[model samples]
Target: MTALLLIDIQSGLQETVYYGTERSNPQAEENCHKILEVFRNKDLPVFHVMHNSTNPASPLYPGKKGNAFHPLVQPIDEEPIFQKTVNSAFIGTNLEIAMISRNITHLVIVGLTIEHCISTSVRMAANLGFHVTLISDATAAFDKIGYDGIRYSAEVIHQTELANLKDEFAQIQDTVTFLTELDN
Candidate 1:
């Protein structure tokens, strides 16, 4: 069966001040909701990966409201929620064992900050033999600074990271393509 893997789509990412910069794809959460609706309507398997940052001062600290899942994509009781401190959902979590146990072979991935958890999870999913379809429009990225003090725009960071993951780690699809496939 195919599963929807939502990585770190938490309230903290909505706080621009917390990230120290604006994020690309302001509509990302909306797109994620749309895809999530499709998955629910089809009764597909869904997994929510929550990032509980180990940094005490980070917005995503376990007790903070920022660590909570965004309301729009919140999981229903039947959906499983996995918590992890690392970038990959599989690391430090039972996600891989759960997927293997359930015989889930294909994954539809979406979430915040493409350069971080999203990138790591996609690569690991592919390496673990799951067919991954990453919804580009449903994922966003924050601006980044290089070691030399050069700044990269959120769009550049988002696109470059997607480029890096394409073909090797995942098959990139936009929200529209993903929805269309679901409909058919």
Candidate 2:
């Protein structure tokens, strides 16, 4: 069965400066919330991945308020939440085992900073033989400085990651497209 994996939709990501100077897809959280609602309503399996930074000063540190999941996509009691300290949600967490135990063959991924945790998790999920569809619009990206000191915009990074992952790692779909799939 298909499952929804909301990866790292944490409050710390809202503090854009903490990640990068600029970020793309500001509506990603809301889109994630929309997808979450649909999964809950349909009684589909839903899993939440939370990033808990080991760095004490980081906003996602365990003791910080910013470590919490964003209000928009907060998990209900029944939804299992997997906490991770690394880029791929499967690493250092029981996420893969949980999905496997439940016989979840497909994963729909959405969440913050597409270039980081989202990308890594998508790639890992695909490698582990899960049918993966990444909600492109529901995952954002931050600007990065190239080796030559050129600054790339968040949109460029976002698009590049999506393109790199397309076909090779996972199928890419926008929030609207995923919602349409649910309807039919």
Q: Give lDDT tens digits, candidate 2, residues 50-93.
A: 99999998899998999999999989999999999999999999
Question: Which tens-of-lDDT digit does each residue in 17-99 have in candidate 1?
Answer: 77748799999998999999998999889999999999988889999999999998998999999999999999999999999
Instruction: Give the whole-model CA lDDT for all candidates, comma-separated.
Output: 0.93, 0.93
* Cα RMSD to the true fold for all candidates: 0.8, 0.8
For model 1, where is the 10-residue window of minimal lDDT? 14-23
How does each model score on TM-score?
Answer: 0.98, 0.98
Q: How many backbone clashes does candidate 1 have?
A: 0
Off by over 4 Å in 1: none
Clashes of each: 0, 0
lDDT of 2 at 104: 97
Model 2 alpha-carbon miss at residue 148, Å: 1.2
